[model samples]
Target: MRLDERIVPYLHMAGLYHLVRLNETWFRSDESLVSAFMERWRPETHMFHMPFGKCTITLQDMAYQLGLPIDGNYVSGCLMDFERYIKGGHPAWMRFEELLGVLPLANCIDKFTVKCSWMQETFGKLPHGVNDATVKRYARAYTMMLLGTQLFGDKFGTCLHIR
Candidate 1:
């Protein structure tokens, strides 16, 4: 299947570079309104607006949790398909596109992949437990957390500095 045709997982989505890039836009605008809510609303969990759901180990958090090497150059994008995913449709996705304004995403995304080799080699499954990505999404949170946090401090510098 084409890469974009496959839903990109948070596993590969929340790279430091990707998050930082996103936050660069997010924090400066009204998007910041969600920060306080995001932090306290559910607390360190993957979230979707409809069905009132949450995934404790959303793929984005897993990268940091698993101590996966962060690829600063890594390019990640959530496929801009929301009407089907959101029952009533929340504006976060649309707002996000607005926050981004515009970019050379088409040029960049074609070259991207889940940067963590171990994540792919070991996890070997698509994202789950949140959104349409699948249901086991939250299943690996605890185990991956235990594994990643143990090494995060030690490997953090490397992950951040690597590119």
Candidate 2:
């Protein structure tokens, strides 16, 4: 709900303004329909055995539906190396705290994980008359939330890796 507009340029620079815009729009979903699909899904084949035929949603379909660009530099890498480096000397949680200016609650987290609600609570509102640095920080946090919740959501559901 906090579309500060100041973050527009930052989001644009990072190639994520379109995704952030989607947050403003209303999207309706049917739980029963989704449950039906889930029931018909064959994870081994990555397809749905519907009554009519086998079907699978392709990346192209998702890209089109989500208004995402199809062509971009292929992103390939692992965070394992970065995590190793971080663990070697730099304290992971300390670094995370330094960057985000907050610590995850112990009861709700394992490893460098924070709840999405915590992110919304912490950075959902921007302070009045803040400087460029603060705006950039907010933009970074917003991008992280978008990626964690929208693009790369996993079994963790509401929790996301802070690293």
Candidate 3:
């Protein structure tokens, strides 16, 4: 089977996991996994995070500081490898930094199942097959994958987590 076709099952799983934990806050007020990941990549590129108030810090806050829409859903940057991609085109256009927050790998099963499922769901929901007006109205939702951060994990080890 083609790679895209094979990825569906995992994406479905990710979607399921996402649904199960829709209200769960996965970040902390201090240095966290997501922060660490951002710090690791930020210095390597043009991205930078601005400081904010509140003892509480989360992806949404970080996204806001980085210029991403705090209201949009996130997908794994790893999905860029797929042949089919929807470039965001809208009022709440998803920014490159918005996708910087990737789905975490809890275990091998979580990596291939939960995370992939979420990415698949997000991809399917991307704006497509619409009229010109609709397209123009939602330009930000149709972001091109030409420029995106790629998520990678250790290939030689079986630790499961990307870090």
1-163 per-residue lDDT for model 1 (tens digits): 0112133343345432232222234444343544433444442343534345543444467566444565466533344543334435644434323422222233222221112333333334434344542322322331233233322211221111010
Query: What TM-score does model 3 achieve against the real structure?
Result: 0.18
Clash totals for all candidate models: 7, 0, 25
Give the poorly placed runs of model 2, Cα more than 4 Å off: 29-54, 76-82, 85-95, 154-157
Q: What is the lDDT of every predicted structure here?
A: 0.33, 0.74, 0.32
**Which rank order by TM-score, best down to worst?**
2, 3, 1
Pick the winner on TM-score between candidates 2 and 3: 2
Error of 2 at 67 (Å): 3.0
Q: How high is the lDDT of residue 142 in model 2?
A: 82
Model 1 off-target regions past 4 Å? 1-33, 43-51, 57-163
lDDT of 3 by residue, 35-85 (tens): 554554443444544454223346776555444444656555443332233
| Rank by lDDT (best first) | 2, 1, 3
Better structure of 1 and 2 per lDDT: 2
Per-model TM-score on C-alpha atoms? 0.17, 0.70, 0.18
